[model samples]
Target chain A: MNIHEYQAKELFEKYGVATPKGVAVKASAEYSTALGQINTANGIMVKSQIHAGGRGKGTFTNGFKGGVKFSPNKEKAIENATAMLGNTLVTAQTGPEGRKVQTIYFTEAANLGKRPDGRDDEYYLAILLDRATSRPVIVASTEGGVEIEQVAHSTPEKIFKVQVDPAVGLQPFQARQIAFALGLSGDLFKQCVTLVTRLYQLYWDKDCAMVEVNPLLVTKEGQLLALDAKVSFDDNALFRHPDIVALRDLNEEDAKEIEASKYGLSYIALDGNIACLVNGAGLAMSTMDIIQHFGGSPANFLDVGGGATKDQVSAAFKIILGDKNVKGILVNIFGGIMDCNVIATGIVEAVKETGLKLPLVVRLEGNNVQAGKATLAASGLTIVSGDTMADAAQKIVKLVNQK
Target chain B: MSILVKENTRVLVQGITGDFGARHARLSIEYGSQIVAGVTPGKGGQVFEHNGVKVPIFNTVAEAAKQTGATVSAIFVPPPFAADAILECVDADLDLAIAITEGIPVRDMVRAKRAMQGRRTRLIGPNCPGIVTPGRGEKSHGGCRIGIAPGYIHKRGKVGVVSRSGTLTYEAVWQLTCKGHGQSTCVGIGGDPVNGTSHLDVIKLFNEDPETEAIIMIGEIGGNAEVEAARWIKEHCKKPVAGFIAGATAPAGRRMGHAGAVIGGAEDTAAAKIKIFKECGISVAATPSDMADALLRIWKG
Candidate 1:
């Protein structure tokens, strides 16, 4: 449900929050036209657009000097954009594998020279739901250049928080309070107040799960600009916002995860060999737990849902076997209203169609247990049957390790 | 006596004409739940037959409550309007309303929760499986079932089970039933991020109920509800409490298919809770079968 920074800034602009002038360029061919859009006095900042944070400090695996580089002219801007476009970016958050940088944003760099207070021109601001209070909280700090997580972990006292009552939305007084907490005055302070207020308005109106403005800049002229932005929307609330849903980038997500969501299935890819297909969320977790306990790693976390049909079950199984790393498959069903016979038939059909070549173990319990077990047994596949959860987990782990 | 509903407890169905509502409504009546009325907006004045037992349908929960005098209401409304349906039951001043719908937006539930502050009505499961208290006598609605749980699996006994999952609660109950220990009641508080009830809420109810001797808490790697309950159990709970937590080996940050199943930044993982439960004198079960053995030892102690 997370949107890219450029998309977030576009949405922010609609809510009257001023974002730095930038044009998202997907290719070096369009770099000249995009650079022409942002008319800056000293050129622009070329930022590689990826989903993960720490992109500013990220490096391109293609031997590019930096994912983000300041270009003094149009020539250097295209050089930086060419280095980033279609290159993989490796940051602390992107893991060792890194994310592919599909677009580079050519943005107007702000003049955040030295302030009179001798401090750098960076501040941290974010709005997120505080689970402890079950309310939206605005977190602000003066130190923003470093990773906010490190600041949050070490010098938490430096971080200030104010919870917003949804009934009142984001009041002007609360925004001013945050503005004052960050130590601002005169025209600069008033600008901060206006910027904070508009940001809160966008967060509230857009139904955003999180709105983070790390290194919210305080320019030499006292004007504020969001140097970096990240926004994630509530997935359940996406039904109300179709325009926002269209901003979802499928290329940024795992293909299996996107495919699973299409079928109303929940799948999380893991680095294990045993694929787990269970009924409920808790059951799936427990199935994974016991597998690890018995010395087996889970290939993926797949839930076919409580009321899944034969086709959905077959779909779930095929998705699991699609992982070539799946040395074994465990079909765990605790059928209550979920007919056990239907699950058995689905497993049988999926195996028949996919042609199972690995170890398969199944444990079925609950309503129509007799018929469901009968169906699986009659499938005539060389599938191991387990009477209990522990027994089933042990069987799969053992059978897989034997190879 | 059970915690919430009993045989004589009159049940009202909200979103009665909907697929889940109509189906569970019939199933509830067959299980001996005294389903007095049904509520579906604009579907009033209709007679719904459940196992040949006729029930009246009302347009609103207010009218249904007024006419049927139903003490409890269970909702199967869709996610978008599920909170409002719950609010209707709350406004009608029902003792409890169980929302069986899943995928309700957290913001809507948070507002619903705030409006429920100091209200007479109690809520359970926006995405949860309903509450079940096994019928004890002839007058009992076969043991009152306010959810989709089948009645055949339950046995009228003392062990109380509270869980954060749907079918996993069924798994725990089956394990208990197989171990010759029938449950007094089982509550699935749903797996949503923000829910009305918690493991501690039902644990408190079970602690007070004389019928519930020992308790089984089914928690996963999520919010610190399990750890909080473990802390409370160490100080106040008089009866033995056994717990089974899922997601022992789950990776951090993944949602694990349940909204409330993510491991928090703090010490809220299953392994962390197991360590806490061990320190609190609560038997922690690794597998569901291990829970059956642990519960047997706990009640016996």
Candidate 2:
């Protein structure tokens, strides 16, 4: 549900929020044409478009200096774009493996306003659901252009939050309160109020999970602008927003995760040897934890949901085996609404279909579980049957470690 | 002396005509719950006949409640209309509305929950397994089964179980049943971030209930509901409590199947919550498989 900075800016613009004019290009051939579309007079900021944050401090695999760069001229902008596109970027957010840069964004750089003490006039602002209150909250801070968590941990007093009543939406007074809290006044203060109002509207109208604008900059010319945008939409609400769903980038997602979705399975890839396929979300998570607790790492977290057919279970097995690191598999089913026999039959069929070589340990409980265990037992397969979740995890960890 | 629904608590089904709703409805009826009526918007005056029992159908929850004296409703309406279904229960002034449907938009729940403020109805879940008060019959049959949980796994006893995950709750219940321990009531508060109820809310009810002598609380990585409940238990709860938190190995920011299962802040991790449980004098289960035993270690029978 996470979108790139360029897409977030486009969304911000659609809702009347002010942001620097920017152009995004996927190919090098479009770089000059894209640059021609934006205001690059003072300087053009070349930003690598990836889902994760810390792009400004990120380094490319090809030894490129920065994922985001400021070039004074058009030629320098093109050169920086050339070095960025198609290169993998490694940041604090992206793991050591990093993500490949598929798109480059060029935006007009702003003249940062300086305070009386010569500090940058920037602030952090984000709109998200405050789980504590079950309502939308606007988080504003004077400190910006850095991790908000660090600011929160270090100086919690600097953070300000305003909870909006869902029935009434965001109020004008609430917006003004944020603007004043950030020490804005006069025309800049008016601009901040307008921007906060528009951002809240966009957040509510678009069903966004979070809309964060780090470094809400005050230009020297007295304009408030969102310098960096990070927006994520709620997955549950995606059904109502087709336009937002189109913004999803499959390239940024793992292949197994995307494939698992097709079968109504929730799959998250991890780095380990034993893959777990469980019935429920909490059980699946605990299945992974128990695996690690038993001295074996889990390769993935896969939940087949409360009800699964033979085909879905087979698809789940296929997806688990897709990960090369998987040396063993654990199937833990606490069938409440789901029948264990169906899952067991699917496992037998999937093992035969994929010619599975890795060891699989299954612990089926509740709702015709005896039939399920019998089905697995009669399949003439080498599936290890555990008495409980802990037993299954230990068996798989032992089996995978034996290799 | 169950917390929410007992054996005779009259219940109704909101999407009784749909496949998922009808299936669980049949299961609930087979388990001997007093399923009095069905709500299908336009399928009024029809009878949902299953296993010799006939449930009268109504066009709205108000009419259903009025016709059958049903105080509780298990909502199986789809995500798009689930919020409306919850509001209908609130408007009808039902005692409890358990939304068994999953994947409801958080925006919808936020608005629904706000509208439900000071209302008569108590909401259980938008994506939950529902509540169960085990009957004294064979395999816990004749019990009041509200949502999609297997009734047979439960046994009417002095223990109370509360969890955020459906099957994980079942795991603990089964473990307790296997250990010859029975439960007074088991409640799944749902795994959504903005659910109708919280761990603290249910724990308070269990603490006051005379039948529930011990409690097992299962939570995962997400909101501070578990922590809040644990803190409250430390001060107010008068029973031996066992707790277990899942997602110890889960990565940050990843929605682990449940929409609310994502790790958000420092205090929302499993390790952090487990530490709080230990400090709060609750028995902490090292793994999911040990939930029942963890309680047995502290409270005997």
Candidate 3:
């Protein structure tokens, strides 16, 4: 689940990560009060708290590129923040959403000095799975921040990796190795170690898929701090961690996805008219490809998953039919552990309940195929049956086009 | 003559007290699997009859394995406790462990894999339809029971089949049966990326089987295992092999199918794997119906 920048920072603070002291103001009046809360005003950065990235560029309508005009006069800061807050900010990273800021973070901004060598130190730290080793690996780079994928791909050697054993967790010595490798010493080095250790704990404790601290900056005073943070939790592990689930901001998620989650079905909305519901993930993807291959677009990719009961199938069907864009429905089941007849019965029941009028095409195999088809046939629903996947694709494509 | 299991192999059922587990356990025993024992933590000391065979229930896999000398284990534990069950079976040094439990965390499987790295124990799946030794014996942990493949399919001569999909494995076996070619062993390695075993792992066993003359591999998208297997087959496999990858036309991106079956980034795709297998001199079946035809051609040649 994706959270807004302010929410992520809030979580970081809760987890004992040092973040810039700030106040989140929802409205223009709140912004006036926010300025008074800033204890020191060397230079305060008013960041639009949107879900998307790249908020720095073209986010503000009036193009306050250098910085928002902040004065002891709280009225000016409020005027500037209100204009940027509600208006959509189109950043390269924000994509098409161009996040509409609900709240803005008015916080103390940091000023940096040159490195020990009179050069800027560039480095970021991230902990992610090392696919090759099948272990959690810590990634540290001299080119801190920006897109780490690009750095890993273009110059992999520059990214220092240390694999952590799950039993021992992330050892301090290993964290220190990364710190020293990144050219840190003294108090700053200790701070870096502490932050890295904390990040690893967050990754394990929260069952996070990734914990990234971008721009792990070494200030002019040689103080190490995580300037930005991003944390992603494993959706499968959400059952074990209720606290992380509470962090989910439903407003930030796609409406269809949120609805699909309620049914315990994995649904990803796509721009297509034919809703494809298949039993297995591999088969579901293949069905989507087949739909596209036949000149039909798949509206959603829905997998009922293995061991799905009749109710779950019905729930999945309802979710698919809920989409107004879906002109046709394709039910593909290669019943492994599941009974095809049970699935067929569920489909018919779901369609009856929803009063589905869309063209339905089904291709079922394995256990109870005959019984499943018989049940569907007996249902008297206007359903089409295909002997094979190719036939199913053709029928669905033809039906969708007819619609 | 069959692969991992046969009529004589002693089988232990884990999670036998559960609804689906009990049902399949009864079916497998009725179908001719040698039901030796059952395991369910608190349900130990109870007796479950499988086709008139009174099997003693044990508290753990270790006890069941020790008492019954069960070489093969059919695990039906739920997702949460599946990893521990598998580890227990591995600890007992079972010859083969079939994890019928679905939805096991990939991280858990990763740890299990690490633990079983050098062990002789072979794992079929954390989520898969359990293997069958044709008409002689079957160990089905999956809920569905369509009956075992007919005895006629086992000419006991050659042909080793490996598949990622359980349903497709049945199809492949059915196709082989129609061609009057019986399988030496049919292995469902499972579709999950971090599953118990890979196609390459099974192929090595098949390659070493003197009775196995040819190999038919059924693979799906989402992992590089198929590609790696193709490379291995090209370099090391002495037996003639036929291959077919399911989901050749699968869309690019994450789609709900199997937890491990998403096509993200660059990896072994159906088409790419097919191309590789073809380059490796293995005949590729274009469709499920054509799989048997492809294998027949290789057998005749």
Candidate with top DockQ is 2
True contacts kept of each: 0.65, 0.85, 0.20
How do all the candidates rank in terms of TM-score, highest first?
Answer: 2, 1, 3
Instruction: Report the lDDT tens digits of candidate 1 across residue range A151-190.
Output: 8889998899999886667888998999899888888688
Report lDDT per candidate.
0.85, 0.93, 0.73
lDDT per residue (tens digit) for residues B72-161 in model 3: 888888887888999998899999889877777656776787788789898987677666655522222211121222222233437788
Candidate 2 residues A1-403, lDDT tens each? Answer: 9999999999999999889999999999998899889888889999999999888899988998789999999999999999999999999888888999999999999999998999998899999999999999999999998899999999999999999999999999999999899988999889999999999999999899999999999899988999999999999999999999999999999888999999999999998889989988989999999999899998999999988789988999889888888899999999876778888888999999999988999999998999999999999999999999889988999888899
lDDT of 2: 0.93
Candidate 3 residue-wise lDDT, A1-403, digit = tens: 4565566667777777776677878788676677778854466667776666566655454555422334344555565676776776777655554556667777766555466676566577888655445568898988775777678789888889899876567888999999888877788788888878887887777766677777777666666656666777655567777777887776566677777677767788776899988765545666776777678888887877656778888888877877888899998887745678989898889889988888999988767789999999999999999877768988999988976
- TM-score on alpha carbons, each prediction: 0.96, 0.99, 0.85
A346 Cα displacement, candidate 3 (Å): 3.0
> Which residue pairs in candidate 3 collide?
A122-A142, A123-A144, A124-A144, A280-B257, A281-B256, A281-B257, A281-B258, B153-B182
Docking class of 2: high
Segments in model 3 whose C-alpha atoms lie over 4 Å from true places: A1-4, A14-16, A23-29, A33-42, A46-106, A113-120, A336-338, B136-184, B190-193, B211-223, B240-257, B262-264, B268-301
Off by over 4 Å in 2: none
Q: How many backbone clashes does candidate 1 have?
A: 4
